[model samples]
Target chain A: MTDDIAVLGAGMHPWGKWGRRFVEYGVTAARSALSDAQLGWNDVQLVVGADTVRGGYPGHVAGAAFAQALGWQGARVTSVYAACASGAQAINTARAQILAGMADVALVVGADAAPKGFFAPAGGDRPDDPDWLRFRVLGATNPVYFGLYARRRMALYGDTPDDFAQVKVKNAAAGRANPHARYRKAVTAEEVAASPVVADPLRLLDICATSDGAAALVLSSMSFARRHGVDPVRIRAVSTVTPRYPRTTLDLPDFATDSAAVVAPPAIGFRASIAAAAYAEAGTGPADLDLAEVYDLSTALELEWYEDVGLCPAGEGVKLLREGATALGGRIPVNPSGGLASFGEAVPAQAISQVCELTWQLRGQAGGRQVAGARCGLSVNQGLFGHGSAVIAVR
Target chain B: MRTPVVAGWFNADDDPDGFRLLGTRCRMCGSVFFPRADAYCRNPSCAGSELDEVPLSRTGTVWSYTDGRYRPPAPYPGTPDAPWEPYTVVAVELAAERMVVLGQAAPGVTVADLAVGMAVEVVPGVLHQDAERTWTTWHWRPVGGPV
Candidate 1:
């Protein structure tokens, strides 16, 4: 459990629709990270790229593609895809390599040029694929699932639409201070109520948008960090666990959940298990975390994450939000970098971006959105299908 | 002629009891799966490969519901010329199987008409129609509502 990797540098290209290739964004972020680490591209011995399905043939082999874009320095390359958890997996792969003594210095990168409107599955008729079948058969877009969760919250926890809108208001205020954020203007609750409904019980403003963005990290072995004369923030743990069988809760891209007729469901849900695994490995719990960056795909989902991350008991996420415990400068600030609400979703780049925010905060480098005296931070997100990821970083 | 959007999902032919959603139950462990787990039992503890086809519960309580206010992207087989109409989707918790199944609500049942824990029953309905065939799919209607 002592195999922690040092984060020497972190960087991101400002997230937005630049109408450019994802490789360009990735290269910019990588160059920035290399410069921040004071190491040239040739100095790194390994590189990992998070794959994006939208990026044609080169995207399929993103590791070699980004390496080629960075002028091919003969670095060992690997590409990984785990839907939205692609970035965390890429980071985990690098951490594994560094801890195993296979590499001294490694770079991890994830970038995406998202499609306009609701994200649909790759084309063609395939009834076997659940991702495709959900859209084709039920017309259940991603927002549909978000709306379902929101409504379920309202029913079970007495959460109101106004409570959901308050999440947008708070995150937008934080986004205004983040130069890297796409939407920098603070939003009013009225605006959220006025926004057209994309799915019932959730307005367009409640949901995160699709965008093109990139994030990168330069990681090194602890010994390498000490020799390089850098006091680096270290990644204590990366949890990339899958859901246990008979997953009771309904997740995205699935028509139905696994039946629990024969066996009882797990005591803790899949989302909770993600953070629990990370905390166990890091030897820290929710109380030890100074801040967190969770995937806020929708305003309601943000409230859900408050509970999922164990900031509060189940069905009491809204109470935490109401008490301002999750806002910036609160008891434990969540998503000080504006989260997906302001940054939108860059998919593969998002989980890495969360870690980047943590790194900057832990190092006291976050200009305006800094959480005061942040010592430890955790980033949690779940990908499409069963990929659940959580990473804890300590200064 | 009538056709199913996806074959073997549910019963399409007319029946008085209405169409029941089809699934598979593990013969060894008694675990049930929807969309038909033809290959193997998904339970981690059970190594049962003999899955038998079975009909799912017709009536269940609504776990949650939502409406799609936007036109979903392609592979959904929507006609561009026609005006888009929002439809309500419901996730119903089948008590017997101890699982939640999601499906479109019966035509004319808006989000206003649905609530969590309301009783709903599965029934066969038309999804869309082409010149040759009328694509059939399952719809969830509140039990004791208009047939």
Candidate 2:
């Protein structure tokens, strides 16, 4: 197991269509995190920013951009872009820097000001880009892939539309209590059903919307935390894993899965392997987790995460949800912070926001949506391309 | 004038099986890659570089299906001036290759006409048309259905 990095502070700019720049949101979140940590911008020796493509050239160099916005103290900087997994990877970078004795305190931030409607690839005729190829050739939007997964669940697991609606209902109820969530109103199963269909087998509410949001964290070495006289929540592990070749399950931005003809498929699926690696590094099993925050880009995807995280056996995610095992007051609450169902998506910021929620829950600071006596929490998200990340944190 | 949306992905030859998807097979490991793997073998265990062009199976079973109820963004060739027409998409699983390939369903095939595990076959179809050229692409059609 790797040494733990202290989560000294966590903060965010409330998610919404704020119509502002991503850099502004990120700087705001960074300031809030710095305040919470009782540290100044100059105190941070390293800064990592999760990049957003929509921000143009400056966004590609997000770490330096945020540093300049925060009145550059000439901190060492790095930027990472792993699609949806960007935030987790940024956190992983900060953790590695602290563990390697490269820095005593590190600032990690991710923010996005998304465009309206469906996300499209960058302009130009790049045939080699899978994101462009899918849209150009197949007209396959992201929801189409989500719809595929939802339909597959119905056929394989007997999960009904009502079952899917329950996920939105549960998450929306929790979202109402989160001040940072964009959609705070409680959503009913009826509302979900009433929502227009964006993709077959999944309605508009089943899929998350793109929005403007930002989340930031201040991570420090254990010695720094001790010197500051702060007992901080610790990040135990950050598992950033890529898919093994011959992945059978169809994923986003891909017209086809790799063939298994040449090699045998891995015993553990990609998503499952993501969580397993985190659990292995954290020296804890799913049973030890008091709460979890997962990438619920779609309601049905959340159910898949239950099985992927080993909360229950495969194909029994619906059964566990039906029994209220994953609800806010359940034995092991999942997404008590309302998940992406509440926050929608801010791309680079979403995964970091997951960790922010976990940090709050672990610190017993999650107001009404709190998982009672939460001690250990997990955050799992998969990015476009083959990136998958799972982080474990403990108080 | 007419053109394939992306060339070399589908057969242009007049074969009896109609149009089949083209992919590359690793000579050493026998791994088949669609959208054609012209480079090195993707299999992590193999370093073999020899790849042979081969036509994939024309028939596969429906693994999952969905419909694009809303218009997609740019690069999709959906005319901005035209009213959006929803199209059904199918992910077909080839048993021999043990891979799931995604493609647009034949025109007029809606979600109502599809079910998981149903038999489907690949057929060439038009994606969109400009003043000069028609973009051709592969579409999945349910077997024994009206086309």
Candidate 3:
């Protein structure tokens, strides 16, 4: 497709609790990506940085911050913030610029230095902010929402805690070989069961942790890749879609779902629509996918994504998991890079890291966790508020 | 001594029969918003500026439920001085409004005690108490269960 852009290189700073500034991690990732592309700093015409709220004022202007840290080459810069989807937004912006001929070569970077324990909202007495109100009013931490979804699945589809624990076990086994993943040990179902419950039905090991990490990608116009005499992985589509009105689903930071009384609900739910738009743009479906990197904020959410991404029918996600249809050497592998189950969450850096995993897998460079004959991969994640994104990459 | 944790969320007075969550309904589109949409109607198709405050339906089916095993972080009003206690949370779907509202489960209602599609009703309860005031909030309880 004419809209496609070549992914020249992808890189990441290993996820962990490094206790460093967000900028430092970003710079490390950017330099590694540039080197992988076999290009110097001056070769990059644009720099797009995914913003991190925890980084103070510099985080807000991340584009300029990264450019400055990389020793300003006068590269045109842009910064975007959409919570967890920030990295995907950065990638989308870079792809758009490359296709529009605004820049022949672009670098997209995202990184975060997260705090310990649960992520709290910004300091304030402002009652107008829904994020703050959820904490103050209901004490609804992110895990609470995860627990709600997990329990609902159990009630509706007969999913058990064992099924949820199996997801962690599979992902952790894959993560054991991934150098960029934070937790590299193979986790057992027994280990997951032994972990304390953070939220009812969701144990400590079943939920993703918050960590410090960074990811970067070097993208170029297809023509630019041709000039370099390289046939690289190309980004087929990036869908950053918002939910339609009368959102019936109760998502994060909100205490209620929209009323479907007046306006009828959308034909497809929000998460389903995200991947549908990408499939429509890429002219491909789940059958064509070699691998997927769905956001596993909680083990249960990964099963939900299997349904949302059209890998299987609704209420059949657990069945797919039970049959090993989603494990490595199965019909289709998910989170071959171990996903958030191993890497934890660095917020802004997360979505970009998914793309990085896709790049490595498609290039056949993913070591022990490689999916056989991987030709195309998809990455999907949902952010706070209404932001959701899915990217498809093909070799 | 009872003050609402967040003002205007519910009718916090001591009348149990009259206790109901307040929300706004759009005049032009009939769209309802809880936590009150006082500024303007949120419906994109409707240009009507009037949003009337209305009390929501008290009873609804349990869409889902969960409980916190650990105390939440700051702005949640928990202190190290007092031992932490886990609390159950419930999301109830109102038939009249065609929406789901979330609140704490009434004291003693655990995740093991609830199931999906079980009917529950909103009731007034205390969230936390400081030296001077007992913070008031809404809780959901099974319709025929303990008071």
Q: What is the lDDT of residue B144 in candidate 2?
A: 70
Candidate-wise lDDT, in order = 0.92, 0.92, 0.93
Tens digits of per-residue lDDT for model 1, B1-147: 898888888975589386788999899998899989888888989888999989999999999999999899988877977899999999999999999999999899999999999999998888888888898999999998886
Docking class of 3: high
User: Where in model 2 is the C-alpha error above 4 Å?
Assistant: A56-60, B13-16
Give the backbone clash total of model 1: 0
Interface RMSD of every predicted model, in angstroms: 0.6, 0.7, 0.8
Q: In candidate 3, which residue ranges exceed 4 Å CA deviation?
A: A56-60
lDDT at position A104, candidate 2: 98
lDDT of candidate 1 at residue B95, scale 0 to 100: 97
- Write model 1 residue lDDT over A4-112, tens digit each, in one string: 8999988899999999989999999999899889999999999999988886354357788789999988999988999889999999999999999999999999998
lDDT (10s digit) by residue, model 2, range A1-395:
99999999899999999899899999999999999899998999999999988763643588988998899788999999899999999999999989999999999999999999999999999998989999999889999999999999999999998899999999998999999999999999999999999998999999999999999999999999999999999999999989988798899898899998768899998999999999999999999999999899999999999999999998999999999999999988888988889998999999999988998898899999999999999999998899999999998
Candidate 1: deviation at residue B90, Å? 0.2
Candidate 1 C-alpha error for residue A118, in Å: 0.5
Ranking by DockQ: 2, 1, 3
- Error (Å) of candidate 2 at residue A162 is 0.9
- Candidate 2's DockQ is 0.90
For candidate 2, the per-residue lDDT at A358 reads 90
